[model samples]
Target: MTLTFAAPTPDAIPLHVIDQSNCDAWLAGQGEQVSQWANRNGFTGAAGQTVLIPGSEGSVVMALAGFGTADTRARKRFVLAAAAAALPKGTYKITSGLTGRALEIECFGWLMTGHTFDRYRTQSPSTALLVAPAGIDAKRVEVQANAEALIRDLINTPAQDMGPDALQQATEALATEFGATCKTVLGDDLLSENFPMIHAVGRAAEKAPRLIELNWGTSGPKLTLVGKGVCFDTGGLDLKPAAGMLLMKKDMGGSANVLGLARMIMALNLPLQLRVLIPAVENSVAGNAFRPGDILTSRKGLSVEVNNTDAEGRLVLADALTLADEGNPDLIISMATLTGAARVAVGPDLAPFYTDEETHAAALFKAATEVADPVWRLPFHTPYEAMIEPAYADLDNAPSGGFAGSITAALFLRRFVTQTPYMHFDIYGWQPVAASARPKGGVGQGPRALLEALPDMLDL
Candidate 1:
């Protein structure tokens, strides 16, 4: 929660952004002593390089941050985070080599660099702070940073303390903050409420399974967000190996990102009525756990056959998505960490999304690039729709042959979302390696691009 940006002050350090294109010109302008300093330090304006300049009295006066070439910038994100890591404790201002969208994204990136999940252990506080850049909404960036922190914190927490009840508590607290109406259908009530699939997947666990719904905004288009909130996945009866279970605590990544997006929508007061539906549960093994070959009816009345208990995310999301569709919202978006096939297709860095609408695809891709939140478009592929339709039920939670796993998963959820423009994001929410501002723990995907593309997607 530390402030990552400082207001403009007289003595803020000058941070010049030099790239390979202008490195020599910048060096020549600084004269011999600085030129020698640059050479001795091997400062070639590479992406992570930095140089400190000294004044006549031998006191530090300014700093140089390397921006590299266009290709270099394309290969990475949050480049200024390197400067944030390199610079000593102080305030700084960008003096050259960035403007417009790049500047705005970097400003937000700089703030994200200050985030660290320290709930379990003590961590050092962030040292460097940047002056909020000119000609952009500083408050917007701060709000987004806070929302991002909330997502990471929720996802990073251990499943031991972050079960279904805890997830509901988090949602309730968030609803209270924004004056939204929040409710949860608990335990046997889930069965009474017709969220049978959600209840079936979670009934084995000690913590009760429930559907959590939050409503906000009094006017504008109705936008429903459905997130798969499997707080922890033991992979049910088809259990995962030790390695697979290591990151199971992050199985609820969808809910975390949904909350982050919900926070942003309410904080920004967007022109949309937002409804968030999260089926909070823990997929655990017990004598009564739902098993393979079991058929469960969803809230949409679609019967789903459990082919693999490991594929539980889509089951929980199916019921929640059905409830969302009953509201007949303008747009239906579902986020889930549902398949390893997605990870194999696009790797961990890119978020692969599926939508039948071309306009949504175009707007989301454009906004993703503009915001440096990378997303790839996967197809709904009606040709493969048969994969999810089993003879035993309306849908199969996991299809045979392991072909088009991500697409079939999307197809399964799409059945419940009958009358809305839908977008399904198959996200690998854990960062395998630390990047610019994002750490190696749980992270968010697709929501930032969704936020930026909302206006055009909904024609607002």
Candidate 2:
């Protein structure tokens, strides 16, 4: 809600957007004095650069911003982010040509430009404001920004403040906001509720683990979402190196992202019966911590042999996905910051998702392109199914060979959803380096693109 649309005012400053292809023509249109001033200041319309023109009075008149060349690869989305961040703190109106998706990206960028994790800081908030562009939907921009900001705030919090108990509280708050029905199976109750895998993974943490569920909407195709909420991953008894554990606070990014997407869906009142399942737990070290070589029974009646306790996200998710599958929902989507191998495969910018259904995969790919929220489709690759099948149990939490880690992880999860059409996202939720619109911290991925694809996928 921090970003708003208002009627134009006489004092509102003008903002011009131009790229390399049109820079010369734009310069020619400007008066000779203005062109000379811009030249003296070295503003040739390179992306991320900005220059402000001085008014006759001491106050500002207008500003110019760049969007790179028409062929620039970075122009894929959020091209106006740099301008939003670089402009002086004042009311401004985009006065140049920007329309359709491009204009939407501009408005989204403007709202996101104000996001900052100032919880423990003394810095002041952003003062920049924008009057909505002519054809843009300001309400859509506000809702999307709020959802993303919630994800960032939740993930950026330290594990001390974001454990299983806290995660359940966050879910409850969201449910309350939307008037959705909320329920939980906590601690030993998980065992009674047939969520033994979830209990096993989180048994060692001081804060007991729980299953968080929310139901919203009443009359449409059933859609279910499962998220792995590993509140803090200490790699269980296997343990992680200090460097490997640095960003583990964001291990629960799957839950955060699902909540964000849920926010958008509910706010827009999309016609679908929505169900969200999150298994909130912490994989910490203790004498009782589940260890490698242990056999655990899952809710689906399949046994999982723990090849590595660090592979706990899928263990928790197995139980949750089994619950989601029991309903035989029309579609199921599971997201997790599941594997380091996924990061190695696609890097941090692009999320790799696995699906057995070709039509669903095609729709997701097309939606990702349209929204510029990057996701690459990795196959279910039925050939790799054997890799996770150890002789001792129905599945191996971690396979012996190091190759195809992300695919094998997906296969391990695929077993729990036997009937529901399923899609899995292996996401690295932390941004290692900050970009124009993306801050270097916990982030939300895949959901935006998934939301874009839903209407078509559901035939709504």
Candidate 3:
């Protein structure tokens, strides 16, 4: 999957957009030669209609795509993606007057439509080439697209193959690619290393649990990413209903997204030391599985009482965040499919991020708006910290009363991240329904906005 953006040649075919009301006016303004060819071919630009005008040199002169009434028209950003997918492999420019965010987002759609996760498949499309708009960076688009694709692919894979060990392998592979240092503490080693909570949550699974670490770059600001890699969350001893367990394979979507963001950082060669910590585990139910009423100690030495084994994502993330905080990174960002409260607040398309740092939140908001990735800011609410307090332990993994579950979860993670500027994103990484650019499957949330905002956040 390599894409190239080069300057378009004079003979490059134009992608013309035609609205229903302005079709005649647009065709009237065309060159006499092009107009005659269009007329002879009966090219009337009706909404969702397409026509190719042939040139005298046996090449396509232009492609006309129709739009419906302006008021009634579908507001799909990637309406032209299907068209792009059908185009021959060549550098192309949208001559449809798209600019600013519209142009950037549409180009992103074009690039994404060209993505095919054929890692174990027999057939895949050749990368589609498109000439980037003037002042737009092709490398940036490629980085974002690659990151999103990686996140989607990882989340879409089943638990059978994408368990903790496989996650370590993926981390090691990325480390090798970027010349980063990689290490892991597996199974009982997690207990020896003081990641008892992580080990306890995953000890019952056949595929052993591990904490994966990757370090890259040097001599700059430090940025750490912590992800909850609950490889297959079956709700442990508490147990989820059959419906709730259906999408448990994607419970590690946060880990996938963090790895995706890490890929972008390494690919762009950002001027910052990067560390990724993933507490990869499978929350399975067995005789040995950690249960409710159990008290576990985390890497930070904080005691956590498990009230509901279903709330396991935060347990793994707590350990990873504690390890990341040990390095005292300038900023720490953690992503997890940690709560249903987030989805109830902002739905699946919008991820909600919690940060005490206003400047970082502003940067993320701006980047999300610019990229159309869409994230809303949720409050840390220091007062809510009391909600997670336990009578017998330092904290309760599951807060009582269930009010502000997402905020309380953020507060729990905040306790583990002391020195660094910390932010937590509670994301629903699966799109329940299909839309313009987002298909109805594993979706990458927050990584795009995070990747776009990082260079500026780190002052690179």
Clashes of each: 0, 0, 0
lDDT, candidates in the order shown: 0.89, 0.88, 0.83
Stretches off by above 4 angstroms in model 3 are 3-11, 17-24, 31-49, 56-58, 66-75, 86-91, 119-129
RMSD of each: 1.3, 1.5, 2.9
- Ordered list by TM-score, greatest first: 1, 2, 3
| Structural similarity to truth (TM-score) of each candidate | 0.98, 0.97, 0.90
Clashing pairs in 1: none
lDDT of 2: 0.88
Candidate with the greatest TM-score versus the true structure: 1
TM-score for model 2? 0.97
Over 1-460, each residue of candidate 1 has an lDDT whose tens digit, in order, gives 7434797898898888888778988899889988888889998898878888888998778888888788988888988787777778888998887899999888888888888899989876557789987887888788888888898899999999899999999999999999999999999999888889889999999999999999999899999998889999999999999899999888999999999999989999998999999999999999999999999888887788899999999999988887888898999988988899999999998999999999889999999998888999998989998888899888899999989989888888888887888999999888899888888898888778888999999887
The top-ranked prediction according to lDDT is: 1
Query: In what order do the candidates fall by lDDT, top score first?
Result: 1, 2, 3
Q: In candidate 2, where is summed lDDT lowest over 10 consecutive residues?
A: 1-10
Tell me the tens digit of each residue's lDDT in model 3 across 1-460.
6434546777556777666677777888987877777678666654446567777887877777654455633344465565565556665666874677757776777777766656667544534456777656778877788788888788888898899998899889989988999999998998888888889999999999999999999878999999889999889988899999999989999999999999988999988999999999999988999989999988898999999999999988888898888888899999999999888888887899999888888999999988878899999999888899989999998987868999999999999988889989999999787654556678888887987788778887
